[model samples]
Target: MSESDSPDDIGTSPDSLDLSPREPSARQRRQRRPWLAMIVLLLVVAAGGVVLTKFLTSAIDYYCNVDEIGAKEGCEAGRRLRIQGIVDVGSVTDNATATEFSMSFGGVSLPVVYEGEPGGIFKECIPVVVHGILRDGVFNGDRIEVKHSNEYEAENPDRIVGETDKGSECSQ
Candidate 1:
């Protein structure tokens, strides 16, 4: 094809000859790239937000002694934490709805009101772990787990009989 060739020599339809405004293929792809990237980025960000929300919303299991309720960090009121203590002698009171009890640890007493009846040897002078939130000076417990795994009791099997006979010396 030389410059001398006329436009009539080349085949051209009436529609092709018309100067209609239409984007090129490369321009279309380029225009679509930003929207594609934005969708992918938005998906990634949304997935990240979901993961962060699950991590933040999940219950944090931080076990603390009853004495550390106000003394230790992350062991204050309004936060969910696990408190372990020996149930005070003659402290448990169970009604139709809930159970109220006081436990002692390191000379500090924490009064707890469990929403349900505790099972598995939940008795006076027994070490128990309660999971709940501390609100308005009292622990609002929803679950109770008696700490039955004691190293001393495990090692001194013979002393268990005498100890049970004498009962716990965990004074209030």
Candidate 2:
């Protein structure tokens, strides 16, 4: 066989068949890994921020009997809440504009300023749930719920004798 035509190839070696070069070096791969980790961390932080915002924005409304509002702790002012009590009959003072009124709760006798129209159940001697926030040593109510015991008698057959009858009577 001629030297140039030899089957034991010369230029056609396995090393010459490598077309794809410039494969990423270990250093380059290591550098890219940090960026990938940073991206994952950023995504996690963003997700946590969203969850925290939702939790903070979720209004926490709670019911407190008359005595709780006048406690030493003062019912944690600035949080939305409902204070249940008897509407102080004569204690309700209608503002000159008639759009606002002030009522008092029994026991603590804390004065609550209410804005907006009062409901039909807003009468005196009724169990009331005032919705608002306790701020500056007073209850600023935006909505009021007057719950009567008789209203629940038909719905709850096993009604107690004095379940809704609890609370103070307004002092005229």
| Candidate 2 TM-score, true structure as reference | 0.45
lDDT of 2 by residue, 99-156 (tens): 3334445446667778766876577666778888877767888888877674443467
**Model 2 C-alpha lDDT versus the unseen true structure:** 0.66
lDDT of each: 0.81, 0.66
Error of 2 at 91 (Å): 0.6
Residue 57 lDDT in model 2? 55
Model 2 lDDT-worst window of ten: 163-172
Candidate 2: the clashing residue pairs are none
lDDT of 1 by residue, 110-139 (tens): 999998889898988889999999888899
| Cα lDDT for residue 160, candidate 1 | 38
